[model samples]
Target: MDQFTLNLLVVGATFALYFGIAIWARAGTTSEFYTAGGGVHPVLNGMATGADWMSAASFISMAGIIAAGGYDTSAYLMGWTGGYVLLAMLLAPYLRKFGKFTVPEFIGDRFYSQSARLVAVICLIVASVTYVIGQMTGVGVAFSRFLEVKASTGLYIGAAVVFFYAVLGGMKGITYTQVAQYVVLIFAYTIPAVFISLQLTGNALPPLGLFSTHIESGMPLLAKLDQVVQELGFAKYTGHSDTTLNMFLFTMSLMIGTAGLPHVIVRFFTVPKVADARASAGWALVFIALLYTVAPAVGAMARLNLISNIYPNGTQSDPIAYEARPDWMRNWETTGLLKFEDKNGDGLIEFYNDKSKNEDFNAAAAAKGWAGNELTVNNDIMVLANPEIARLPGWVVALVAAGGLAAALSTAAGLLLAISSAISHDLIKGSLNPNISEKGELMAARVSMGVAIAVATYLGLNPPGFAAQTVALAFGLAAASIFPALMMGIFSKRINNVGAVAGMLSGLLVTVVYIFLHKGWFFIPDTNSYTDAAPLLLSIKSTSFGAVGALVNFAVAFAVSRATAAPPQAIQDLVEGIRIPRGAGKAQSH
Candidate 1:
């Protein structure tokens, strides 16, 4: 069968399975819609959480980031993984013990103020919306290539699919559907890595293969990658070229952001008890590690494969003629993500880092009649294109297509659910209409999700950055606005409602403004007053500004709390109660 037909068959089969699961597990009440009726097993919740956590950013863009940026992008892996640890240790159990339906609800009650909930809702919507833009971008990229459609059309299709499953099933349906998604995505991700690893290193395990010798080069795989990339004017594969402060801050942002994310936080609520929440977190970490450990291998191998393809005779020799390039390049070119221009009219594509600091390489390229770099490959395409680039079977490619969709759609559902819940459950029912019936609230939740999806789809078209970069920005925002609030609310009895509201607003505003100054107001192109290359702050990129914002939040909250009255005695008692084991129902502050 043709490639398109194979993709359609595999992708369509996955979609059918997802729809079937959603239908079977469709939620029937507010409880089911909100928290899967609180009955999901720990292992199952962990699996679903894995799928929810590994969005298109993790599945599609993370390896690409690693492949292209090499060691500089390790922050993403470290940050996201560490962020989950933070969530599990510092936040998950306490929040689960609180027995709230959403993060905003928890904040509202804990702070003993409706305004705190409203602030959290705003923070949740902003962060969740930004995060969904990344998922939508991943969806568009995957569908655009595999389904043979325009990126916008692919986005609409993705949004529609999410609408069906997420709106119909709610958390109950989404939970089970995400479990199935986890299976598909992990297999899809690791299978190709295993194939590529075996092809390159003669090792079955991708992680071990990364440290193994390259079959063709007789050098360690990473050493071979470093040699090839540096020879072609790229940085060493294992080099740490980024600023230490930026990497530290970026990782911190992602870590705190992961802890603060409402969608991820809500996963714990789906379990029956606080202990289940902790167990679920452990299982999620295990599942997450399976993919995380394999990623560096996949990235290094794919980078080597790409370089080898371009310089079949080695970097010192002439590159392959444009017309002689591999079929993988041709396939990706159709999506406009991989482009080759015959610079200098040589009919040969020279793919190298033109801005490399190597003077000898620059002189050689100039002597050899090379102009600027002739090939442009989007970093987001690397993982999805890895199988084809390594000449894996067509079935593997099709499986990858399904896996990418599953990653993007699964996370999209979770994010939209968070947004919808914040709106319908926190904003509407809690604040606007306390008398809203369960049915009405559920309907509001569905409608809110539909609107969130539409908004996300629109923003996806004009995303501020690539999938992973956009996600990092969302993490920064979340880290700045939400993490401090949750921590303060749980750990500090003195942090009153005024303090929480002030801290969240100040943190969110500062971070958003910093991002807007660099990334454009609301991410409109060319409207930014500054760029990440020359940041307004001292070497702090907007993506890494979350840590700074978070500090600001903490400082502001503490100052405000001390300047004002302490929390009510009952509130202090409630905070004390939450720290103890089995004090959930017994605490009666609010």
Candidate 2:
């Protein structure tokens, strides 16, 4: 079959499977819609959580970042995964015991403040919306590439599919569908990685193969990558090149952000018991680690593969002829992810750091009769193009297309649920219409879902940045605001409404202002007043500032709580109740 037909068949079949499951698991009540009726098996919930957590950024863009950034990219893997350890131990069990429909609901009831709930709602919406935009963009990219449609057209189709499944299945449908998505995406991701590892190092294991000796040159894989990159005037693959302080803060930010994200935290609420919540987190990590561990390998191998393809005879010779570039190169170039400029009227494509400040490398290139590197490829293309790069069969390439769509669409559905629940359940029903009927609430949820998807699709067309960086902002916002309030609600019954509100407002404002100063206000052009070259405080990049914001939140909450009257005795009892695993009442329906 042709590539397009195969891609359609695979992607369509997956969508049909999810749609069928949604039909079978149609949520009959608000409890089912919000928490999957709280009977999801721990292992199944873990798989769903893995699929939920590993969005387009994890499945599509993570390896590309590692490929381009090398050792510095370890922050993503470490920060993202390590945060789960914190969630499993410190937060997940208690939250699950609380047994609420939404994160804000827990904070509202525990803190005894409507305003506190509102603050949590705002924070949740911001983080979830920002994160969803990245998924929409990924869906658009995947669709356009594989389906031969424009990105906007792809987004509409993707949105339609998500609407059908998400509106029909709600949490129950999304949860089970995510399990299927996890299987498809993980298989698609690891298979190419294993093949590349075997071809490069004669080792079957991608992670170990990354450290093993390269079969071609008998040098350690990392060492070989470092040599080739340096020969092209790029930073060494295994060396630390970024500032230590920034790296530390960035990693911390991602960790806290991961722990705080509402979409991920809500997954724990779907399981049956507190222990299941904890165990599910561990299982989620195991599943997530499968991809995380192999990611570095894929990145390094793909980088080496591209370098090798460019310099068929090594860096000691002329570049590969432009017309002789691999099919993957030509295919990706059409997507604008890869580009080539035939500088100096040569028919060859040079791939190197032509703008390097290294005088020695510049002088050497000049002596070699080369003008500059003529190839430009976006790092995001590495994963999606891996199968094509290895000359794999069309089925493998088609499976990858389905996998990318699954990754993007599954996360998009999850975020849409979060957004819809926050609006209809938390904001509209909680505040504006406390007497809303169950039928009315369900309709509201569906309407909110439709609106959220529209907004996400609009923003995705005008993306502010790459998937990972955009996701970082969302994490930072969640870490700064919602996470602190939820933690304080469970751990400290002394925290009053005033303390919770003050802490969330302070953290949210500080983080948003700091990010605006660096990333532009609302991410519009010409709004940013400062660059990373001269940061506001301690040289912290906007992406790395979330941890500091979280710290600020904790400090402010404690200080305010000490000065104010403690929460009522009833609130203290509520806090204690959520801490244990037994006798929790049935979760409320609308």
Candidate 3:
């Protein structure tokens, strides 16, 4: 069968399965919609959480970022993995025991203020909407290439698919659908890695293959990769280029951000008991480790494969003529993601770092009469195009297409659910209309989700950065605003309503303003005063500012709380009750 037909068949089958699950597990009440009826098995919930957690950024864009940035980009892998651990241990079980329907709900009740809940709803929407934009971007990239549609058109179609299942089944459908998505995505991710690993290093397991010798070069795989990239003016594959401070803050942001994300935290609420929540988190870590470990191998192998294809001999030799470029290049070029322009008007395509500081490489390029880098490859395309770049089988490529879609759609559903629940549950029922009927609230949830999907699709067309970078910004916002509030609510009895509100607003405002100054106001193109290359702060990019925002939140909360009256005695007792290990299991029963 042709590649397009194979892609359609595989991707269509997965969509069909998602719809089937949605219908079979359709939610009937607010409880089912919000928390999947609170009866999902721990292992099953963990698998579903794995799918929910690994969005388009993780599946489609992370490896691409790693491939281009090398060691500096490992922060994405480290931060996300560590953040999941932090979320699972520091927050998940406690939140689940509290038995709130949403993050804002927990915050509102814990702080004993309706104003706190409303502020949390705002924070949840801001972070989740930003996150959905990244997922939609991935959907566009995957669809534009495989489905042979314009990126905007792909986003519209993806929105339609998400609307059907997400609006119909709510969390109940999303949870089960995500479990199936996990299976498809993991198989799709690991199979390509296995094939490429064997092809490059004669090792079947990708993690081991990463450290194994390159079959043809007889050198350690990373050592060979570093030599090749450095020869072409790129940084060493294992060398750090970003500052230690920025890396440290970036990692911390992602870690705490994971804990704060309403979509991820809500997953814990789907389990039957507090212990089940903990068990599910452990299982999720194991499942997440599967893809996270293979990602580095895939990135390294694909980078090598890509450069090897372009420089058939070596970087010093003449590159392949533009007309002689491989089929993969032609296919990706159609999507406008991989492009070649002959700046020197030479027939050959030169793919190298144009801004390299290497004098010897510059002199060599000057002697060769090279003008500048001619090939522009988008980082988001690296993983999606990896199987094709490596000349893998058509089926493997098709599987990847399905896997990428599954990853994007699964996370989009989760984020939209968080957004919708925040609106309908926290804002409408909890605040605006406390007497709202269950049926009315359910309709509001669906409508809110539909609106969120429309907004997400619109923003996806004009994303501020690549998928992973956009997602990182979302993480930063969550870390700054929501995480500090949740932590203080659960751990500290002195954090009154005024303090919680002050901290969330202060953290969110600072981070948003910092990002806008560098990334443009609301991410509009060419409207920014500064760029990440020369950030307003000292070596602190907007993406790294979340950790700083989080610190500001904690400081402000403490200062404000100490200057004001203490939390009510009942509130203090409530906080104490949630923290006590012995009574934690009984609280779930209450």
Candidate 4:
């Protein structure tokens, strides 16, 4: 069957399964909607948390970025994975012991200030909403390809499927849905890696395959990739050309950001006990490692495969003629992901890093009758195109399409849940209506879900490239604002409402402003006063500014606390209570 038909069947089947599960697990109470009634198994919650954590950024974007970025890209893997360790150790169990339905609730009560809760709600919304934009775009992009619909139309379809499960089930719905999604996404991700690894390196294990000799070249796979890419004027596949300082800061920001994100931290609240929260985190890491460790292999192998196809006789030989490129390239060309221009008019495509120009490179291009680079390949295409690039069957390609959708939709659901809970549970019920009925609160949650979806759809219509960057930015924002406040609330007895509020706002404002100055004012696409290329502060890129923001937050909060009255005795007692696992309650605290 044709690829499109196969994609439809595969994607459609997964959607049906998700809808079935959502219907079976429809939430019945506010508690169910909020924290799956706090009764999930550690292993089950671990799987669900894995799905919630690995969004479009992890599944679709990470490996592709790594493929293009090579060694410097390790920041994403190291930072993101390491953040969970911090979350599990420093935050998860304490928050679970606090017995709160939402992160803002913990902040509000521990600080003994409604205003502090409001600030947390704002922080959560900013981070979660921004994060959803990318997942929405991922959904739209995946649908546009598999369904052959306009990007916006495909987005609506995917959003509708997510709404069916997420709105109806809340935490209960999402918990089970994410478990199924984790299975689908991991299966889809690993199957192709296995096939490609065996095909390219004659090794069944992808991680081992990365170091194994290439089937065609006697050299190790990474060495072969380095040689071929450098021959084409690209950096070596395993070279660390980026400044070590920037890499360290970026990784640090990501790690801090991961531990601070509300959506991810909220998953720990679903388990029955503080101990379960800790165990679940360990399992989540194991599940995450399954894909994380395989990604470099996929990246290295896919890069090698593409170059080998374009230069069948080797980089020293004539390049592939444009008219004679493979059908997969032709297919991707229609999506604007693969572009070509006959710059040299030899009907051949030459792709290399123009930025890596040198005397030898110029001389080689002249001798080879090559003009400037004639191909522009988007990095995000590497993973999506891996199956086709390796000549895998149509079924595998369709499964990948499904997997990408699952990744995007699952994370989008988790983020939206965080956004809605902040609005309804924290903003409306906590502050606006102390006496609001449970049904009224649930309705508010659903309405908030609708609003978040609308905003995400609008952004996804022409999603910025940075939409793919929300994962890191969200983590940074969380690290800078939420994580510090929460940590101090549990670990320190003197941090009062004033200190907490000041710290959160200080961190949030600095991080957001730094991002805006470089990324453009509000990411409006062209209104920025500065750029990450030449940052205003310490030559640090805006993306890595989160760690700085976090440091500032800690300093400001301590200074403010020293100047202000200590937290009320009631609040101090509450913090002390949360630090230990005893006296934990069954029902969530308002």
Candidate 5:
């Protein structure tokens, strides 16, 4: 079969499977819609959460980014995985025990203030909407590549698919569908990696291959890769970055952000028991680690493949002719991710690092009639192009395309669900219309989901300037604004509504302002007062500012709580009640 038809058949089959699950598990009640009636078994919930947690960035972009940046990208791995530990330990069970449909409900009830809930809802919407843009845009890109549709058309189609199941099935539909997606995505991700590992190192497992000897070179795979790249004036495949402190901060920001993200946290609420929430988190991380460990191997192998492609005669020889470039390079060149300028007009690709710290090689390449690096490969394409680069079978390529869409859609559903709940459950039912019927609230929730999808798709088309960094920014906002408030609400019963609100505002504003100053004010390009590479406060890049924002939140909240009177004793009792595990299943029985 032709590649396109195979892609259609596989993708169509997976979509059919998900749609079937959505229909079978269609939500009938508000309870079903919001929390899947709190009946999800911990393991299945964990698998669903794993799907919801791993976004397009994780599935499609991580390996590519790691390939381009080398050891520096380890921050993403450590930070993201480490966060589940914090979430499982500090947040998940307690939030599930507090027992609300959304994060804001707990904040409002725990603080005994609708106003604090209002503030939390605002924070949730901001952080979630920012995150959704990336997912929607990712869906568009994945659709454009595999389905061969226009990017705009793909975005609308993807949105319609999500709305069909997500609006109907709610949490029930999404959770079950996400389980199917997890299977598809993980299979797609690991298969090619396993093949690449076997080809390069004679090892069946990718993570093990990363450290094993290269069958051809006789040296460890990573060491051989480093030796070749460094010989070509590129940084070592596993070298540390110049900005060690910034990497630390960035990793910390992602860790805190991961724990704080509302969509991820909400997954715990679907399970029946507080113990289930804790156990589910462990399972979720176990599922998540499978892909996380494979990613570095993928990155390292892909990088070696590309460099070897350009220098078929080894790094000591002239480059391959431009006309002889393979199908993968040719196809990506059409999308402009892979480009060559024919520097020196040699008609051969001159691929090397233009800004290497080693000046001797820079001068040597120039002396060798190499007029600087002519190949401009976008970092994003490495993973998507990895299969073709390795001459893998077409079915594997199709699977990868399907996997990318599955990843994007899963996370998009989770984010939209979080946003919709904040609207219907928090703002409408909890505040404006406390007397609204369950059926009416469910209707409102569906309506809100549709609106959220439309808004996300629109922003994807004309994304705010910050959309490129939306994932990181989303995490930062959550880390600073949401995480601290939830922590203080549980750990410190004395934190009044005023203190919680004050802390959230302070953290949120400072984080946003710092990002804007570095990225752009309101994300307008070139409007930044300070670039990340330029000097900024405390020698921290804006990308790494979330941890700092979270600290500010803690300090301000504690200081304000100290200066003011303690929360009333009734609220104190509520806190103590939540601290125990016996009655959490009925926390919302009121």
Candidate 6:
């Protein structure tokens, strides 16, 4: 079968499987609607959380960023995974013990203020909505590249599939579907990586292969990659070039953001007990680490593979013939992720950093009779193209396509669930209409889910920013606003309702304005006047500014809380109860 047909068959079948599961496991009660009935095994919850957390960023774009940016991009790996440790030690168990339907619900009841809950709801919706746009975009990109459809068409189809399962299954359906997604995504991700590792280094384990000697060059793989990329005027593969302070802050932002993300936090609520919540986090990290450890290896090896394909012999030798280039190159070229031009009237492709204004690199390229580097490749294409580059079987390639869809769709469903619950349980049920019936609230959740999907689809159709960049905003908002409020609610009895609300508003406004100034309003173009170089304040890039915003939140909250009366004794008791694991049970509608 043609690649497109095969991809369609594989991806279509996987969607069918998820839809079937959703139909079979449709939620019936409020408990099922919110926490999947709290019957989920720890391991299964761990796997589901892994699938939920990975999203399009982990599955589709992370390796590509690592491949292009080299060691400087290690912030993504460290930040995203390190956040789980924060979640486990500081947040998960307590939240589970509190046993809430939504993060905003916890904030509202804990703070004893309707406005505080409303603010939390707004933040939750904004973060989840922004995050889901990236996922829908990822699904579009994968489908367009593999299934031979326009990105818009792919997005529509993807949204339809997710809506089918998410609206039908609620948390119950999503949890089981995510377990299946984890299986598909991990298998698809690892198989091609293993093949490529063995092909380049004769090492079966990709992570070890990254540091081991390359079979072709008899040098350490990373060392060889460094040499080749440097010769092409790019930074060394394993050396840092960005400012250390910025990297540190960026990593910190991602870590805090990860812990604060509502969709991820809600997963802990589904586990049967507070102890299981902690254990589930450990298991989730184990599952996440499986992909995390292999990612750098994939990034390094894929970069090397790309360079080898372009140079054929070595950077010192003549470029590869255009006609003899692999099918993967021609295929990706069609997607505009990879491009080549026959500069200097040569029939060969020269792939290098043509924009290097450095004198030494320019002199070298000039002496080599090269006009300029003529290939432009998007970093997001690296992981998706890995299987094809390694000449893996058609089935493996199809499976990878399905896996990418699974990763994107699973995360989208999770985010939608969070968004829906925040609207229904926290906003409508808590304040807007306390008399809403269980069936009425369920209908409201479904309506919100459908609307959330529509908004995400529209944003995906006209992406305001890159996948990772947009996702970073979601993290920044979460880190600056919701995380501090929740943490202080548990850790400090002095933090009053007014204090929490003020702090969150300040943090949210600062972070949002900073991101908007750099990324533009709603990520639309012609909106940003300053780049990261001329940022709003210090040497901070918007991506790293979340930490600063978070600090501002803490300071404001502390100042305001000190000026106000302490919370009621009952509220204090609730905080203390949340800290301990005893008597934790299925969270109910308040």
Candidate 6: residue pairs that collide: none
Tens-place lDDT per residue, model 5, 140-175, is 766766766565677788899989989989998999
Clashes of each: 0, 0, 1, 1, 0, 0
- What tens-digit string does per-residue lDDT give for candidate 2 at 1-590? 78878888988898788888999999888878888988899999999999999999898888888988898888988888888787777788887777788888888888888898898999999889989988987887788778776666777888888889998889999999999999999998998888888988999999999999999999999999999989998988888877889889888888888888888888888887777888899899899998988989998998898888888898645678999988777666656657888877778887788877789998998787778878877666678888887777888888888888889988998999998999999999999999999888988998999999999988887665667777877888888998788788888878889989899988988998898777655556442122343567877888888888888998898899899898899889988887787655445553
Pairs in clash, predicted candidate 5:
none
Off by over 4 Å in 1: 520-524, 527-531, 583-590
Judged by lDDT relative to the true structure, which candidate is superior, 3 or 4? Answer: 3
TM per candidate comes to 0.97, 0.96, 0.97, 0.96, 0.94, 0.95
What is every candidate's alpha-carbon RMSD to the true fold? 2.1, 2.1, 1.9, 2.0, 2.5, 2.1
- Candidate 1 per-residue lDDT, tens place, 267-342, comes to 9989888888899999999999989999988888889889889888875456888989998888888777788888
Residue-level lDDT for 59 in candidate 2: 85
lDDT per residue (tens digit) for residues 1-590 in model 4:
88998998998899888888888889888898889888999999999999998898888878888888788888999998898889888888888888888999999989999999999999899878778987887887677767766656778987888777889889888999999899999999999999999998899999999999988878888888889888888877788877777788889999988888888988988888888888899999899888899998888888888888898888545788999999888877766657899887888878776667567876877787777888877666678889999999999999999999999999999999999999999999999998999999999999999889988888766554633465677777878888889889889999989999999999999999888776755546542122344666766777788898889989999999999898878888988888887556554746
Candidate number that wins on lDDT, 5 or 6: 6
Error of 3 at 377 (Å): 0.9
Q: How far does residue 512 in candidate 2 sit from its true spot (Å)?
A: 1.1
lDDT per residue as tens, model 6, 1-590: 88878987888788878988999889998789889998899999999999999988898888888988888888999999999899888988888888888899889989999999999999888888988988998888787688565666778888888889999999999999999999999998998889999998899999998888999889988889989988888877788777888788888888898889999999988988888888899899999998999999999888888888778777555888888889988887666557788898878887877777568998888887888878777666788888887678888889888888898999999999999999999888888899999999999999999999999998887665556766876887888888899889888878989899999999988888887775545456542122343555655678888888899999999998889888899998888888887778887767
lDDT of each: 0.90, 0.85, 0.91, 0.85, 0.84, 0.86
Residue 306 miss distance in model 5 (angstroms): 2.0
